[model samples]
Target: MNLETFTLFNFWSSPLLATTAEAESSSLILAGVLLSLAVIYLASKAGGELCARINLPPVLGELVFGVMVGVSVLHLLMFAEAGEDGSHSLIMNLLQATSPMGSTTFSHVFEAQSEVLSVLAEIGVVVLLFEIGLESDLKELLKVGIQSTVVAVIGVITPFVLGTTGLMLLFGTPAIPAIFAGAALTATSIGITAKVLAEMQRLNTREGQIIVGAAVIDDVLGIIVLAVVAGLARDGQVVVSDVVYLVISAAAFFIGAIWIGRLLNPLFVQLVNHMRTRGQVLLSALFFALILSYISATIHLEAILGAFAAGLVLAETEKREELQRQVAPVADVLMPVFFVIVGARTDISVLNPFVPENREGLIMASFLIVVAIVGKVLTGLGVFGQPGINRLAIGVGMVPRGEVGLVFAAIGAATGALSDALNAAIIVMVILTTFLAPPLLRWAFSLSEESATTDPASLSGNISEPVLVESERLQSELVKPEIQ
Candidate 1:
């Protein structure tokens, strides 16, 4: 029963007791991949449920579970070296090894599988962004455009400066890692913030509108920064002309995508709606998103950006609700995969305070967390000139970095621009900000409510009410033609 002496036919005839090395190795790897998916989905769902029970975002639980099962804890998905005599390692055997695949072969297989999972995870984020765009009202967004832009600008600038300066001064880290730290800190996860706001029944509030609007603007700005930093990292130096080119290209892509998408949306919708097929509209919507995503990637911007723009185009159509309904199921399946992948990528070892080797990383993480918090808090002040607004609530609402921050950190790590220690620190900061924002925001809104309730005179200069009315009017006008 020597594996080296057996033919492929004999190995295929009895897969479990395969005698051919190639057949056995391939079968084992396939089984491992299937098992890994099962484990990841189950762990992610369980963790999400646990977090929900504790009144926290389910993503937190999913991420923590991923860390638990990943290399940092259970070592279930990590690839380790083979044993002596070129045999399969203990993990491979435990997962049901059929033959010895040397460490190199196993490593290659594992890496390939990981890349596949990563692609799936990225698609999940794209779907999530598309959904966000679908739910958004572009008209309302424009009403708060000025305020949102200011808040977004300040939010990006303050965090970037603080993150870069703090890392250089406190940790004496190299410039690339410091820049990445700053970039990571600039991400504000609108999904998490919007969910919390909706749960608290404040999504229609002025502060809520401002927070959501600002987050959307922040996303666009953050992507541009990421593109610039990635370019600088690749070239190993920031050429002034190169920086200008990157900035212009990014700007042109975003503006052009939105403008062209808007111009063509009506015609596209009309064409899709005229179709007699049952699900033609939904299919067309998905195709549109995928095509835009492809275009974004082709132009060197993130695909998610194109997906978001596609959603925006579809959002303006009369079939927006129908499109959203059809896409929801797909998003649900893939989005969790993205979050879990992010969690699995996080290395818990560097965050262990008890480990002497991790003490510096732990200290650096602590400092970054502080900076992340304070920097976003200052963004609340950008709401100046608007009365009766709880700036604190707005700022707190903007604090959670969530999936967007994770994406930035993942990019940095993948590019080798961020070291393990720095990546760990960024993740810690992301986790803390995400974990703390919900309760803090709830408390801030409560204070605002109490103040408004206790004093009738406190509403003298409230502008949100009038703006809300105007927003309602604008929405009515936009929907009037469809209603007819």
Candidate 2:
């Protein structure tokens, strides 16, 4: 429908929707934002619930719903300008029949809206990483120690090699795109694995501990790889000193933040406890997270790193329970927005097998999925010397690329390092991995349990009681204290 046809709706006819006039533009933008939020929220919620019903991750449903409403499907949120023929673009239609305002005005309006959504999505990711950090115990991670480090190192290397090699061999992709593809594969989304483990009540298990620990270590390594790749993409050549600088900066940021956070958290908690206002602790925790996130961004690292560090610090405080309780609702609201936006960014046309031109993308996506899965699975083998550990389960748990992979792909696309075909391929690979991992993990865990009970001798190794006990103890410590 044209802009005029769209503006005929009583909703747009309201004076609040006027945008062509200079005086009314701000109000029009605000109204449009509110309307967009409403649509995104309702659509995301419905999609999440639908996915849950079918035993898939709610994220998959949210993403699919985003596509359904986005440019690829309904074209409800397209951001293009009107063609030379003067037909209204979707954004123009939403602007209440604003006249053909040329590229500059269209860019301004589009950017304003897109920027808001992007910021919200970024915040959602920050909250997510924060929660993961909060749930993690540094002490337990230490205990998992060398084993997890081994698994994580292998996890990163194997996927990267496989991804790069496969892309080059299968599609004869260029070096830069191959590197981006490899980098994308290296990310292991702990959120998906954590959710699956939590659901199956295996979160406190030995295997779970190793997976979580390895995933955490994996995150650190993945971020470093991302920095290097981003630098290479921008400069068109890798400078050793630049790479070294990023490594040092990222490492210092994490270690320094954690060290500083630990030292300051007690004082911060004490100050909050003495505050007369209710929820002061929660507010303080959030402020700290936001501050750290800003600092991380300022240092050219991912903001989520600082947010995660903030969470680790806060997790050590006396008010962990209260902070978690207060933060849960906020995280719940923002997290879905990230996943939906991720879906919305996806262009489904590249995945249309019926389109002859898109066949390469389809082929690349298929091979990428295989590479993503096998790469992570090999990490399970790194869990050596520990008998009775479910290696398959560990690998399967780490399978879902989830938001982490999407973040890498998004960076590549934004930097013009990845083509449309490659981006679509990465998105499809991410979606399939995210969707497939949970059920596979569930089956793996079930098999582990059955083996333990019915055919203990058939298992490769015995479950380590000491490790399991420590894991349980750590889990107990991580749990929020009950309010009286």
Q: Report, for every candidate in turn, its global Cα lDDT versus the true structure.
A: 0.77, 0.77
lDDT per residue for candidate 1 within 400-478, as digits (tens), equals 9986887787788888898877887888888778767877887898898898777856565475689898999999999
**Candidate 1 weakest lDDT stretch, 10 residues:** 80-89
Using TM-score, give the best candidate's number. 2
* Model 2 per-residue lDDT tens digits across residues 114-156: 6676778789888877876676666665677788889889999
Question: After aligning candidate 2 to the native by TM-score, how far in Å is the CA of 333 from where it should be?
Answer: 1.3
lDDT of 1: 0.77
Residue 299 Cα positional deviation in candidate 2, in Å, after optimal superposition: 1.6
Candidate 2 displacement at residue 253 in angstroms: 2.0
Q: Score candidate 2 by lDDT.
A: 0.77
Model 2: lDDT of residue 72: 71
